[model samples]
Target: MSQAAYIRDMMSDPASDLATGPSEVSSFYSNLNVLLTGGNGFLGRLLIERILRSCSGVNTLFLLLRAKKGKSSEDRFEELFDDVIFDRLKREKPGFAQKVRLIEGDVGQIGLGLAPEQRELLRATNVVIHGAATVRFDETLRTATNINVRGTKEMLRLAKEMPNLKAFVHISTAYSNCVREFIDEKFYPPPIDSDKLLNLVEILDDAPLQHLTPVLLGKYPNTYAFSKAVAEDVIRRNDHRLPVCVVRPSIVIATSKEPVAGWINNVYGATGIVVGAAVGLLRTLHCDPDMIADLIPADYVINNVIVAAWDLAEARNSNINNADSSKNPEIDEPPIYNVVSSCQKPITWGKFMQQIEDFGLQIPSMLCIWYYCFKLNKYEWVHKMYAIFLHLLPALIVDSVARIVGREPMLWKAYKKIHKFSAVISYFATQQWRFNNNGVLRLSAKLSPADQNQFELNMDKFSWSEYNYHFIRGLRVYIVKDPLHTGPKAVVRYARLRLAHYTLISVLCGIIFWLLWTLVRFMGI
Candidate 1:
């Protein structure tokens, strides 16, 4: 049965037991103090917004932010609230911003760059949410290791100093163990000893390290995944015995419903492609149309994160109470939850593309360069040919015309960059992943009814059509920064571009046919 149908059946069947729900989950965070890293990031911002708006029992969120652009971390904290996300909070939950306090620090630094007083203050934190890491797939091994591997080690060290630390929720990716086809909610052995790799990365120079990268990343696809896999190992291998749980969420998109329905702030991950395609710049993608697009909403991910923190903390408390009477100590292991859509409402790439295209036509972007039409091809060579003929050829012509007319030539550069980026992401798009999210379902079932509704993470109840429509609208408004009033102009431009595309194809075919006929007559064959 489809996950959606299974969930529906579970909800309707009164005969089945739902008593595994969280008996004491609801008010676990009353007067709870939190120490959160990655305050200025995309997910960081959403998590903060959700906590302030929804997690009412929470006391304060002490964010660790690095000072940048000559601004103090405290000064830069103001910039975070200036986002449209906080706009809703500022009006509806007027004083919720008061719950947030910024501490000057960098995860990459010694002791997380925390000052003595800051460290002392953070010692009072009962819960630690480690959401900080460089998530780019193409990041260097040295860089990814420092932040993902070493940084996590530093956070665990800091967690030890926290006299009251109950739960440590580390944000990981579902693809960390992606080398395997069917991933269970368990940690695989590290590819290499993390400590050895860390030392080697520190000692090796740049050029040599670059040369050694492929050798180091053997079975792993990229440095990001390798580092994350090793980071998970770091946590699993930790001797600190601290309460820990890793939340692995897949392809996080805009909010389905939360601070605002379909609210997105950045153009990272799939957001770039969504916005790029909506603005009519992206035309072809090298991806399998049948592969499952394991997308989970940012808000849903956040909701699960919050509840997971509560549940994990409760489990640790139970362990403490049963410490003396322990039945084999229950594996001293931190539970991992795979927050993905595949185990729930699985949507194929073909369906996802159709939804995006349908909505793109309905709510056209003002900044569109062409019609919102795109092809998803499984063949890499076909995509390459399309890139050359359809993408670069037109781009070169446009850029050449601009150069001739004394305008800054840019279209060719844009296409080159676009194709390069498409190449980078195509690896994942063509591959199918079957993530086992039994852990996620078990987590949800563990939640009390009231807590379940308040912090719902179930994708079975989600409607994709409505979500896609609002998401495109949100992309237009928030990410594209385009006005709704410009829709009419965008539609006209789409029509013009479509006409130009057809005319160009016709002209090229006619020229080829004419040349062939002339050659045949000249030969007298």
Candidate 2:
């Protein structure tokens, strides 16, 4: 169907929009002036598109963007419209772009570095959605803290200044406090105080800080998780009077079922592993097959965020007049929703891996034969040995060649850098953490059946076999792109190489058997 037709179908029924969930209070859609941070990112882009098409009565959407290399915030907003993700919006309403206004600022700076006009836009905003954060797992502590922790602090401070702000939603990760095996719906502060860590980071130089990050993070997997955990604590402590909600989503993957099924834009999460395995780059994963793989789609996450915001706003408003009652209304705290899939449906790592291998082989290309053979016969020890040899021996050989050629050996250094980066992420892939998602289930149950169908987060609805097909398709169309469509070419090259390799091995085996027979005959046995 054309983009216009799709938009009409979605907007024709307001109840079908995933964002329009069941709420206790009526008329929650009136006069919503939303200020969304990270509006240029993948999830942010989808959220904005959904809101514009579904929520027609929204007053305005103020996008918080930082100035890029040579482009101003206005220039960036214009460029964002050119992306295909917004094609649906462009078709639905030619002037839909008018509702979105860009506010130039830096999240790391105070008041988000907004000027007078930008602050004016923020102050008038009714809802604030903070989605901007450094997602890099191996990012430096200084940079991560600056963007993740301090940036959130600045946004919260700005929210405090907004007189009409009804709800402030902070996007966080389910693995923020992943060091613990069982995570419940409660705030667990980090071992070290957030303010003290921020202070130490502010005074120390980059070199010394990088050296101390390992010791500082301690039991935490990486700096990303550590910083995000600290950021959540900061939000909880800062939101004493205002209504705030924290959404902690598990390892976010592609869209399960939405405007487009299995739609993914980035290759950072489990999608990366699937892509690597499809191309024969990843062979043996050090993980249990039975471990639960907690992955929630980006659109589903945004849906929950909107619902949580509305719920928090209503909850806060209800608590306002009851301050003098015997119940002590001040004790009513903000709810921290764990938006995960453990309760609804849990997928096993082994099943996911098997499906990816099958789907990669089914794609129409010359690569299919090799991928098929790799999955059937050569995927055991041979592929693992080959990976180790290619990853390790090349650097050693290159360094030797470089020494002979009278040049510095840089290949080994580059390999070390990549190895270090992979090591940090491998921990999560090799282990599993249990996040109790009773709160998400309870909240979801409160929604109407139509709302449940619109915002589908239940794992029982996902078919691993079908999803795997779209997963590969999404990788080709989005992650790898058209220019890199070399699956057919790779299949041919690997097939010929494998043929030569097996022939040589067979001939050597025959010669060894013949030699053993001759020795037995000569010994007159």
Candidate 3:
């Protein structure tokens, strides 16, 4: 039976063992002083919004943010709240903004770049959610290691120092163990020792390190996954018996349901794919159509992260009360939850693409350069042929036209960058992995019906078909900055583009046929 059906049956039966009392989750955060890194990031921002809105009794949320592009941490925090995602938060909890406090720090720096007083202040933190990391697949090995590997070690070190640390939730990617076909709720042996690899990056110069990256990465596909795998090992080695758990989410996209439906703040990972295809920029993708998409919504991930912190802390408390140190105490490793969709609610790439095309074209973007059309190739050679004809040829012609008109000739350059990016992500797209999400189910089952409703992470309950409709609409509003009010005009414009696209194709075919006929007649064979 599906997890949703099982949960529904369990809830309906009064004799069932599952708890139906007031939520322990929100109560766990009562008077809880939490320190959260990556509070300025996409998921981090959602975390802050959800915690403040859902767990009303929680004390303060200390956001660890570093100043970037000359903006002070305080300035950045103010601007962060200006996003439309926070609009509903402002209405529901008028005073939610007051709960957040910013601490200037960089995860890449020594001791988190904190002053002595700032470090002392964090000693009183009850919960720590380490969500910060560079999500870029093509990031430099040095940078990826610093932020993902070394940064994790530093966070663990800091968490250990906290006198009141109850739970430390580390946000990781489900693809961290992508080299393996089947992944369980446990740590795989990392490609290299965390400390040893850190030392290597520290000693080596950039160019040589870049050259050595492929060799160092070994079976891992990219720096992001490699560093995250190593970072998990860092936790395994240095957690120091803290209440820590890892939450690995796969291809996080827009919010399924929450403060707002289909709300997305960034165009990373799958969001980029949807947006690129919707805008008619991305024409060809090299991927297995049958491979599972493995997309978990952002709200689901946020809910799981919050629940993981509570669940881990509760487990720690229970373990303390039980106190069985004699029974292989060293075997008590941190729990890992693979927050993915495929286990409970699976959708294939072909279905994913068809749904996007069906729903997305209905509300096409005004920013679209061509009619919304894309092709997926399973074979690399076939994909290359498609790329040359469908992608590069058009791009070359457009760029040549622009150069003649003295308009900077950018289409070819843009396609080059787009192709490189597509190549980088094709690794994940072409492959499928079996992620064991039994831990996630157990965690949800442990939640009271009240908590489960408020902070829902059950993937079986999420409808990807409906979500894709809103996904495109959200892309228009948030990413494209085209609101629903303008969608009608955009739709009309799209119809014209669609007509022109087919017309051009027909004319080109006719010209080719005529040329062939003339050559045959001239040859007189």
Candidate 4:
């Protein structure tokens, strides 16, 4: 009933004062110090921005970054300002950047590669958000295991050291357990023991390890999901000392709201498919029309991450005061939240395709290659045939023309990459997964009313139609980085392409008809 009783018996954390109001939540974050991993990533950036913007009381954001591309972490931190996503923060609070401090460390390393002093400083952190991982589907087993699995292990090690740590939000994917059709808000056994895998990887050479990958993965799709699953198992087995929570978000796409609508950085996950089809590069995809497109806005996922941390913190604080461990033994197991849309705001692949087609016409890509046309089918064989006629053949013809003109033949390469992308993504597109999100809903209910509004993870409140429109527009601007002014030109180009396509079809049909007439005459029937 009331928030106080709900917290004590329900979550077993006696310190939850959130039953009182949003002020308590705010007061909790005020003057708090956070240790954040993967601060340079798309989701990481959103998390940092939300924390600074939502909780003004948050004092310091200590980012864990290693030297990348010959640049120090501090140098890369300066480059964050150049990103359009942070423009709002810069304009609103000129000194907002002051709150973020950099810690030089590599998660792939033992002990997180942090200096003794740096580790000591992190010991005072209030919360640790570990979101760093190698997300590539085709990544080598060694690289994937090192970054995704070993990296998480290091985060747990660091998290255990934080004396004031209230919660450790370990970001994972809903697809980690995709081997099954139904995934509940709980940890399933990993494919292999984390430590054993680590030791095995270290003992075997690169060639042997790569060869054994297929055997190691077994029913798993790729090393990314395989390693992430193992990483979760690692956290599950060793999460006793810290207040750990696993957040599994399914198919995260562009931002629906906040800072900017339709904001995205990379052409990964569903964004690649959406952008490729909208630009007329992708023609056909093998997907069951009825399969749920469990896509969530990046900002929505970020909201859940922030609120989850606060929820766990308030609960932990409440526990320290009253020490009611007997109330809920279920608390002995780590809390798992599945942040997915299928259970709340389900969008079928058929609906998503129509949305893309509709918005695609309105927001044509600035440099459409064909005419922004595509199709989706449930049959895998048909998809393969379409890939040949609609994809490979066309790519060959285009590349041949480029070769004749002495220009670089690139279309074939692009199509090859597209084929690989489709092959990998089709696993989810062609299948159905029923993820239960009752835990996520329960987590949201625990947030303060004010926090609930500011940190918006309510899927019931999400508008699929409206968000999909902005999502397409976001691909136009952010993913492709195209200027809005060029949309009109793209529209005209699309019109011309359509005319040429029709004319070519007419000529080919006439040629076929003439050949049939000649064949009949020769038969003399």
Best by lDDT: 3
Model 3: residues >4 Å from true position, as ranges?
1-21, 325-331, 510-525
Q: Give the range of the ten consecutive residues with the poorest summed lDDT in model 2.
A: 369-378
Local distance difference test, each candidate: 0.80, 0.71, 0.84, 0.82
Give lDDT tens digits, candidate 3, residues 48-146: 888987786788899999988999988998898997667656766799767787888989876889989998888989999999999898899999999
Estimate, for each residue in 174-256, the C-alpha lDDT of model 4 and write its tens digit: 99999999999999999999999999889999989988999999999999999999999988987546888889999999887
Candidate 2 residue-wise lDDT at 48: 83
Give the lowest summed-lDDT range of ten residues in model 4.
6-15
TM per candidate comes to 0.91, 0.82, 0.93, 0.92
TM-score of structure candidate 4: 0.92
Greater-TM-score candidate between 1 and 2: 1
Ranking by TM-score: 3, 4, 1, 2
What candidate 2 gets wrong by more than 4 Å, as runs, is: 1-27, 69-71, 321-331, 364-386, 393-421, 483-525
* Candidate 1 ranges with C-alpha deviation above 4 Å: 1-26, 69-71, 323-325, 328-331, 508-525
**RMSD score of candidate 4 (Å):** 7.3
Q: For residues 166-236, write the lDDT of model 2, one tens digit per residue.
A: 88889999999999988887789675777898898889998899889989999987889999999988877
RMSD of 2: 5.9
Worst 10 residues of 3 by lDDT: 9-18
Candidate 4 clashing pairs, residues 3+ apart or interchain: 14-318, 14-319, 15-317, 15-318, 15-319, 16-318
